[model samples]
Target: MPIESPSRRHVLQASLTVASSALFARAGAQGLTGPAYEVSPWPGPLTAFSLVDTSGKTWRPADFKGRAVLLNFWASWCEPCRAEMPTLQQMADLYGPEQLLVLAINFKEAPARALQFAKRTGITLPVLLDVDGQAARRWGVKVFPTTLAIDRHGQPRLRVQGEMDWTGKAAEKLIASLL
Candidate 1:
């Protein structure tokens, strides 16, 4: 491949600086969810996240800025993930206006199954269908209920793998502060 010219490099750097400065606010992942598991400081934006929710509307990740966001990868087959749905719904109902977006990306599960699970479990959290599983690959999500907390500026603040009491008081305070 040919090398970039000086001017091109300058432009690339400038764009990176801007994306970085603004993106400093948030992210979520697949392999492991938090800063502790990030292989690099720059993980890039969580990719191509647009899915229809229960209400038959499209949703995407970028829409969650200006508030704390949670990105969670789950499957209908995962019991712990199912168990955590109500708590997540409670949080969404609680902090949604403050910009707390919870994107529960259904991994490899049929949209119908995910839809059924959400309704059966009273999971009011917005569910995104990861049909190609590319979102999971991009986020490096290896386990169920892997969660990343993205701040108001859209930076990844906390990442937790495995099940968590997502609506607990401590979690509420941390997420609220980002608003």
Candidate 2:
């Protein structure tokens, strides 16, 4: 039986707008933006560790500065990891070293096994060796094929667990947004 005041209506509208924006931002950060990723908002310093590739060159998270890094922890025995290798390789080629660096870190596996898997899969991406499981422990990797998307500043941003279609449109859009 009474009309609402102008100030009250303005406040309600503003509150609704803010709420909607927050919801969308949270959803986008969580890889729910129509992408095949399972993103989680991980805004923190990356776990520190040092690992080498087949060439014996040491690598750290900080070494990937100035470019987004896709640090994937996987094992040769993981079927999902093997299944995702080609798509990962394709993504690596698409982004290249200047934009996105895809690091396929073999989890506690022998160099021979890692090399053999890469060879078999024709994976051209740079493969890092998580020898002795030190790096895996530091990164808190409990599952196979865990992919962490790190920003250019060496900060962990998004984490995608399980396998994914990295070559799909949703993935491309998400990576492009990061770039």
Candidate 3:
């Protein structure tokens, strides 16, 4: 059998896997297992946004008023983003939309692609489309899977800058604080 050379996609995937493993290992070693939470990063009004969900319903900050909101910025191609999605859905299910609104804002991806991922993954949370990447930029989400927790009063409270198990105790406590 001839030894086959790896394709660009395969090589990139391998590299990303290695990099992610190393990053997680280093973080674990330093006892940084959960997402990095920044309290009062905005310290003011919630960042305004008007995006449509997979169902073509427009969502705005006002739509989530009086409920704690988790605005998760993610991309279909990001491994961490994909991994954390289930936990996000779990969180959404646990709290219910009336109390905690979990919005998965697709970062710089087409609505069709985002909807496809959601359908394929059985994601019940509202997947909002940020096709132009403007929403992510406005929210200051430079990293994939970054989540911002907004208080019931529509004030941005916490900024989580990585993937996390939303069902975990640390995450539970952090989210409960918003409520």
Candidate 4:
């Protein structure tokens, strides 16, 4: 093992700090870093739609009003979807039913399977089964773990296409902004 001298360590730390700052600054300057929502007013109340949580409680889309809601399209077949669940749980821990809503829409998965998966994995977020893929079509979801951040007015604010580091400082701040 090579030990870095005090001067070398200082230089390395300074370099790392500068690099991190530059990335953030560049992202800000580009102005295309955040998410963009293609739909507005969330279309309509999440009626005609049915979702069951681990406890068998049904959640209508309308139930998520007055708060920022996340429409997540996921499947047990997707590796990323399962891998990113912990981050989703962390977000759930941070935001309550009043501030933010995390709705996990499971695609083509049977209710029993969804419930079983949730129980085994400890995914507390309400998992709605999209048995017919109709709900996924409404959201234009082409991939697993696609997330839509909808404002209180039902307008979609951001659309993320993959697993995200939701508990990161920037993500937390962004959600806070919505709140």
Which tens-of-lDDT digit does each residue in 1-179 have in candidate 1?
Answer: 99899999999999999997666544432333343222223244655667766567787766876777877788988887887777788878876646777878888878899899888877777788878888777877787777767778877666666776767766666676556
Q: Give the alpha-carbon lDDT of every model.
A: 0.72, 0.82, 0.85, 0.75
Query: TM-score of predicted model 2?
Result: 0.75
Locate the minimum summed-lDDT window of 10 residues in model 3.
35-44
Sort by TM-score, top down from the best: 3, 2, 4, 1
Question: With candidate 2 superimposed using the best TM-score fit, by how many Å does residue 142's alpha carbon deviate from the native?
Answer: 1.1
lDDT tens string, model 2, 42-148? 56458677788976888887688799988899998888888888998899898788889999999988998898888888887778998798777776777778888
- Name the best candidate (by TM-score): 3
**Predicted model with the maximum lDDT:** 3
TM-scores of all candidate predictions against the true structure? 0.68, 0.75, 0.78, 0.69
Q: For candidate 2, give the lDDT.
A: 0.82
Candidate number with the higher lDDT (1 or 2): 2
Task: Write one digit per residue (lDDT tens) for candidate 4, span 98-147.
Answer: 88888888888888888887889988888887788988887677867787
- Model 2, total clashes: 0
Which portions of model 3 show Cα errors greater than 4 Å?
1-40
Q: Of models 1 and 2, which has the larger TM-score? A: 2
